[model samples]
Structure formats: structure tokens, C-alpha cells
Target: MISSSRCTHLLLLLPLMFSFFVMGFVDLVGIASNYAKADYQLTDTTANFLPSLVFFGFLLFSVPTSILMNKIGRKRTLLLSLCVTMAALLLPVFNKSFAGMLAAFSLLGIGNTLMQTSVTPLLSTVVSDDELSSALTFGQFVKAIASFLAPLIAAWGVHYNVFGMNWRILFVAYMLIAVLAVMVLSATPFSDEKPADTSGLRSTFALMRRPMVCGCFIGILCHVGIDVGINATAPRIFQEYEGLSLTHAGRITSFYFICRTVGCLLGTFFLSRVSNRRFFVLSVVCIMCGLIGFAGFRSETALYLCVALIGLGNSNVFSITLTQALQSCPEYKNEVSGLMIMGLFGGTIFPLAMSMTSDGIGSQLGAVAVMLVAAAYLLFFAFKIQGKR
Candidate 1:
């Protein structure tokens, strides 16, 4: 029979894991931006702005959200985020204008920013240090489930005209899930650890002065830049190189997430048995190889293979780098969480940069070049992780 303590632990974890699914909602921005571009007849640079707007909140709101968590606790902050996400998802269903969609995505970014900042540290509160990496990987695995599903669901909605919503059905479906997440998480009790001291923006920024914290911050920046970069660009690559329709090209994004989902599932077990530094180095190598393939190959098959490499390799980067930063300064997990999450603003920087580079060069190779630079930084970061030990 299960002990009450063990049962309670599982109970606590289930809600948090579901929250990770909610966190995955932000990834919809990729396919959604593509769809929005097609619908509005937008230029590549203008379409890129959708995702940039979505992630821009990380730069503006992450540190403040951490400060908010200190006052209200992580659980409450998480709930607020879910509520905002619900609003975001609900908006496009009613307002189909481009401006309306822009507003919706902006709210989605802000909500996700709040959720991302709070959820990982909140997970640390429930699990011990040893289990944290595995737990975080597992959480990402759950998140990837939602991430991979977004494109599939959008495609399904477009094909079937589900409830006459077309692609906007993605918003409705996710809104319902966000509502469910809010309900389930609200009902479950979490013992939120109050921060030992208050954290302001200044103190949060100061955490970056520490080498491990700074390196991990850049690691996160590169990790997210690549993740968002691929999500936003892969489908276009398919279209440019293979002459595929938007619907067909969209599957490329789903395929990337599918590979990532598999990698995260495998990582959950592997991280428990292996050292983070070793696993991290291997993951970075996979991404570097994938990016190299992207630059050199033009075949559909070759591109798909490269996507798989990147997805698998990048699957556990966020968890590993985050765990490193949190472990580096156990006392300031909240502040560090904020600073590290702020690195996600790299999502904004990368897509805009990639878009301009690709547009200027008149080839997707320019975008691949940008991601290769990010991959190279991750490779360098692997050495830093080793040095930390």
C-alpha cells in the first residue's frame, strides 16, 4: 500500500506537471504566427514580430513577476498567469482582426512569462535537490506533449472546420485546457516556501554577476533562441526548400516537437543516471551537428533529419542549465529563476535577427547561420559546466 506521504507527493506533482502543459501553450505562437502571416498576407519580418511580441514580455515582466511571487507566493502567481492565459486564448476567438490577434499573443507572452518564472522554482520546493533535474526534465516531457499537439490540433481544426472555428479552434481548445489547469491547480494545495528576503530588480540583476549564474543565463538565452528560432523557421524552411503548402509545412514544426518530446522522455530517465555535464555536452553536440546539416543540406529528408537532431539534443537543455544555476545559489532560487527566465527574451532577439538575416540574404541559410552561432555558444557553455565541477 502507498504511504500517505508518498501519495501526497504524487498528488502535488500531478498538478505541477499539468501546469507545465499549460506552460507549453506559449509555443503555439510559432504555428499561429505562420497562420497569421498567411491570413494577413504579412511579410516575413512582420510575421516574425508576432513571436517577438510574445517573448518580449520576458524581458519586461520576468523580474517583476519574480518580485510579485515573493509577495503573493508562487502558487498564486501561477494561478494569475493561467487566468491571463485564458484571457489571451479567449480574445482571438471573438476578435479575428490582426490587431486583435496581436493583442491576444501579447497577453499570451505575458502570462507565459509569469508562469515560466514561477513554475520551476515552485517545483524545487516540492522535490529534493537530487530529484530536481529529473523532475524538471519530466515536467518538460509533459510540456512537450502539449507543444507537439498544438500544430496537430491546429491542422485538424483547419481541415475539419471544427465548430466552424477553423484554426482559431486551437485557441478555444487550449483555453479550455488552461481553464482545467487553473481549476485543478487551485484545488491542489502546495506549500510555497517564502523567500528569505525580498528580491527587487536590482538584486535580481546582481545575481548575474556570479559566473555560474551568468553562464547559465546565456545558456538559457541560446537554448530558447534556438527553440523559438526553429519553431518559427522550420515550417518556412520546408516551404522554401520543398515548395510545400502552409498546412504541409506546418507538420515540420510538429515533427520537431515530436522529436523533442521523445528526447525529453528519454532525458527524464537518463538525467537520473548520468551527470548533467556529460549529458549536456552530448545534447549540445547533437544541436551543433543538426545546425551544420541545416546549413549544408537542401533535401527534404536531410532537413527533417536535422530537425530531429535539434529537437532531441535541445530537449533537456533548459532543465540542465536551470538546475545548474539554481544549485549554484540555493539561497536565491527565486531571484535566479527570474534572471534565468529573463534570458528567454532571447526568443525575441533571435527570431527578429533570423528574419532580417534571411530576408536580406534572400535565403533561409541566413537564419541557419544565426542558430549555428547559438549552438556554438552552447558548445562553449558545456566547457563552463565542466569547469563548474
Candidate 2:
């Protein structure tokens, strides 16, 4: 029988994990970027601005959100993030103007930045140290469930014309879920970490003095860059090489997310028994092979196989890198969490780079070239983690 205290703890953990799903709402930027590109007849460079705008919020808001958490408490901060997310989703429903979407994507980034700043550290308080890595990976699995669904939902909205609205209906559906998440989380009570003095940007920067912290920070950048890069480019790859229509090509994005969702689900179990260093290196190698195979081959079957490989390989890198930073400076979890999430600006950096490279070379192969560089960095990071356990 479950003890009362254990039951209470489980209740607290549920809402915190549910917020991870909310955190994933930002991934919609990937498919939304393509939709906007089609609607506007945008160049690769211009359409990428949608995703770039979304991640740019991470650069501007992440550290401040951490400081805000220290002042307001993590739970209240999380609620604030949800409120911001709801507002962002509503903007598109009311007006689908280009400027309106830019604003919506920016707010979406800000809300997700705030949620990422608080959610993991908040989860750490409920679970034990030894359990932290696997627990976070499970949180990631929940997050991927949302990421996996975004493209499918967008595709459905496009096809069915739900509510006489098109892809914008995806925002409406997500906004409703956000409202539910907020209500459930606000009603639940959990003990908060006492506010910390190290919330300042100066102190957050100081933590970079630690070698592992810096390495993990860059590792995060590469992980998110590749994740977002693949998401934004997968459909285009199909369109460019196979001459498929956008609606049909969009399924490739869904396929990538499907593999990623499965990878995170498996990671939660394997991470319990396998050394993180060992598992991380193997994952990196899988992506490296995928990228190289992609650069060399254009066959439809090879494309599908390599994309699935990239998805499976990239899946656990974020959770693993994040848990490493948190464990490295357990006392500084809040500050470190902010700095690491700030690295998500890589989502902005890579997509823009991929865009220009594609434009410069006049092919999606330029984007593939950019991802290969990202995969190479992850491989090097993998070796850095060897024997650390």
C-alpha cells in the first residue's frame, strides 16, 4: 500500500511533469515556420525568422526568468509562464498577420524559456539525487509526446479545416490545454526552494568557470540546434529531393518526432542501468552516422532511415547534458539551469545558418551540411564525458 506521504509526493510530481508538455508547445514554431513560408512565399532565410524569433527569447529572457523564480517562487513563476503561453497562442487565433505571428512566436519563446528555467529544478526537489537523471529523462519523454504531436496536429488542422480555421487551430487546441495545466498546477501545493542570492546574471556567468559546466553548456547548444534544425528542415528535404507537396512532405517532420518520442521513452529505462557517459557517446555516434549517410545518399528509403537515426540519436542529449550540469553544481541548480537553457539560443543560430547555407548553395544539402557540423560537435562532447561516472 502507498503511504500517505508517498501519495502526496506523487501528486506534486504529476503537475510538475505535466508542465513539461507545456514546455514543448514552443516546438510548433518548426511546422508553423513552414506554413508561414508557404503562405508568404518566403525564401528559406526569411521563413526561418519565425523559429529564430522564438528561440531569441531564450537569449533575452532565460537568466531573468531564473532571477524571477528566486523572487516569486518556482510554482508562481511556472503559472506565470503558462499565462504567457496562453496569451501567445491566442494572438494567432485573433489575427494571423505576419507581425502577429512574429509576436506570438516571440511570446511562446519567452514563456517556454521561463518554464525551462523553473521546471527541472522544481522537479529535483521532489525526487532523490540518484533518481534525478532518469527522472528528468522521463520528464523529457513527456515533453517529446507534445513535440511529437505538434506536426500531426498541424497537418490535421490543414486537412480538416476545423472550426473554419486552418493550422491556427493547433494554437487554439494548445491554449486550452495550457489553461488546464495552469489550473491543475496552481491548485496543487508543494514546498518551494528558499530563494537564492546567486540569481544575478553575474553569478550565473561565473558558474561557467567550471570546465564541465562550460562543456555541457555548449553541448546543450548543439543538442537544441540539431533538434530544431531537423524539425524545421525535414519537410523541406522531402520537398526538395522527392518533389512532394508540402502537405505530404510535412509527414517527414512527424516521422522524425515519432522516432524522437520513442528514443526518449527508451532512454528513461536504459539510463537507469547504463552509464550516462557510455550511453551519450553511443547516441552521438548514431547521429554522426545518420548525418554522413544523409550527405552521401538521396534514396527515399535511406532518407527515412537516416532521419529516424538522427531522431533516436538526438533524443537523450538534452536531458543528459542538463542533469550533468545540475549534479555538477547541486547548490547552484537554479543559476546553472538558467545558463544552460540560455544555450537554447542555438535553436535560433542553427536555423538561420541552415537557411543561409541552403540559399547560398541553392539546395537543402546546405542545411544538411550545417547539421553535420552540429553532429560532429556532439560526437566530440561524447568523448568528453567518457569515464565521468
Candidate 3:
């Protein structure tokens, strides 16, 4: 039987986990961008900019958000993120123009930067150090569910014409959930650690001087660069190589997320038992293998297999890399979390780079080439892990 204290902890965790679901909302930019491309006839470079905009805030806001968390506390910081996200979702419903969507996604990015920075540190407040990796992986599993659903919901909205909003219906649906997330999280209570005496920008940046923290930071950059690279490119790959319609090609994105969802779910258990370094090595191997297959194969079956392999491998990268950074500076968790989340700016960088390469080469293979570079870095970073757990 669980103790009352353990049960209370679990109860409090429910809202925090739901907030992870809200974090997944930012992933909509992938499918939403594809639809936007079609809706507005955008060039590859222009459409790619949408997801880039969604990630740009990570670079700008991550450290500042950490400082804010030090002031207002993590829970309140999270609440502020949700409020911004709610406004982001609300924008598309009222204005469907290209500029409007861009503005909305920009807000979504800013909101997500805050949420991503706060959520894990907030989780640490509730969970034990021994359980932090598994707990973070589980939270990611929850986030993956939201990631998995965004494409399907948009697909369904497009197919069924949900209230005639079409794909924009996704924004409406997620907005309502954001509203609920805000309400639930507001009512639930959790204690946060006192602010560190030196969470300033200088101290946060100084962490990069440590080799372990620095390597993990680059690993995060590569991990998210690969993650968003795949999220935005998978459908395009299917379309380019298989000649599939956008509707059918879009399913590849869902398939990728399905594999990612399963990976995160399994990781939540496996990470607790396996050596972190060993697992990281194996995951990078899978990604490298998938990238090779993606570069060489045009067959639909092979492409699908590659997507699955990459998704499963990449699923736990963020959690493992982040756990390393957070544990490295246990006292400056908020600052470390901010710096780690800032690496998500790689999302912006990778997609734009992939887009330009694909455009220049006239093939999705260029994009795959870019991701291969990221996977190579992850492979190198895997050996840098210091622990058995």
C-alpha cells in the first residue's frame, strides 16, 4: 500500500503531468506549417520559417525565464506560460491570415520556452533525485501523447471539417485544453525551492565552462535539431520520394510520433534500470542507422522503418541529456534548465538549414544529410556520459 504522503505526491503530480500535455501543443507547428504551406502556397523556406519562429523564443527567453522562475516561483511561471499559450491558440481562431498564424505561433514559442524551462525543475520539487530521470521521461511520454495527437487532430479537422475551421480547428481544440490546464494547475499546490543566490546571467552562462555541462548542452542542441528536423521533414520526405498526397504523407508525421510515444513510454521504465551511457549510445546508434537508411532508400516500407527507428531513438534524448545537465549543478537547477531548454533554439536552426539545403539540392535528401550531422554529434556525446544510472 502506498503511504498517504506518497499518494499526495502522486495527486499533485497529475496537474504537472497535464501541463506536459500542454507542452506538446508547440509541436503542432509541424503539421500546421505543412497545411499553411498549402493554404498560402508558401515556398519551402517561408513555410519552414513557421516552425523556426516557434523555436526562436527558446534562444531569447530561456535564460530570462529561468530568472523569472527565481522570482515568481516555478508554478506561477508555468501559469504565465499557459496564459501566453492560451492567447497563442486563441489567435488562429479569430484571424486566419498568414501574418496572424505567424504571430500566433511566435507567442506559442515564447509560451513553450517558459513551460519547458519550468516544468522539469518543478517536477524535481516533487520527486526524489533517484526518480528524476524516470519521472522526466514519464513526463516526456505524456508530452509525446500530445505530440502524437496534433497531426491526427489536424488531419481529422481537415477531413471532417470540424466546425468548418479545417486545420485551424486544432488551435481551437488545444486552446480549450490550455484553458483547462491553467485552471487545474492554478488550483493545485506545490512547493518550489528557494531562489539560488546567484541565478544571474553570468552564473548561468558560466556553467558552460564545465565540460560535462557543455557537452550535454551541445547534445541537447543536436537532439532537438534532429527531433524538429524529422517532425518537419518526414511528411515532405514521404511526399517527395513516394509521391504521396499531403494527406497520406502527413500520416508519416503521426507514425513518427506514434513510435516516439511508444519509445518515451518504454524509456520511462528502461531508463530507471539501464546504464544511462549505454542507453544513450544505443539510441544514437539507432538514429544513425535510420539516417543511413533514409539517405539510401526510396522505398515506402524502408522509409517508414527509418522514421520509426529515428523516432524511437530520439524520444529519450531530451530527458537523458537534460537529466545530466540538471544533476550536474543540483543547486542551480533553474539556471541549468534554462540553458538546456535554450538549446531548443536548435529547432529553429536545423529546420532552416534543412529547408535551404533541400531547396538548393532539389531533394529531401539534403534535409536528411543535415540530420545525419546532428546524429553524429549525439553519437560522440554518448560516450561523454559519466554514470551507470
Candidates in order: C-alpha RMSD to true structure: 1.3, 1.2, 1.1
Model 3, range 1-389, lDDT digits (tens) per residue? Answer: 99999899988898899999999999889998999999999988999999999999999999999999888889999999999999999999999899999999999999999999999888888998987888888888888888978888898998999899998888989999999999999999888776638468998899899998888888988998898888889999889888898878888888988999999987877877888999889899999999899888999999999999999999999988998887788878888889999999998999999999999999989999999999999988898886678
Between candidates 2 and 3, the one scoring higher on TM-score is 3
Full-model lDDT for every candidate: 0.91, 0.88, 0.91
Off by over 4 Å in 3: none
The CA lDDT at 387 in model 2 is 54
In model 1, what are the clashing residue pairs, if there are any?
none
- Kindly list the per-residue Cα lDDT of model 2 for residues 78-178, writing each as its tens digit: 99999999999999999878999999999999999999998987887798887777778888888888887888888898999999888888899999999
What tens-digit string does per-residue lDDT give for candidate 1 at 1-389?
Answer: 99999999999998899899999999999999999999999988999999998898999999999999999999999999999999999999999999999999899999999999999988987999778878888999989989989999999999999999998999999999999999999999888988678978887898889999999999999999999999989999889888999998999999999999999998888876777788899999999889899878989999999999999999999988988888889888888889988999999999999999999999888998999999899988987784332
Estimate the TM-score of every prediction.
0.98, 0.98, 0.98
lDDT of 1 at 156: 97
For every model shown, the clashing-pair count is 0, 0, 0
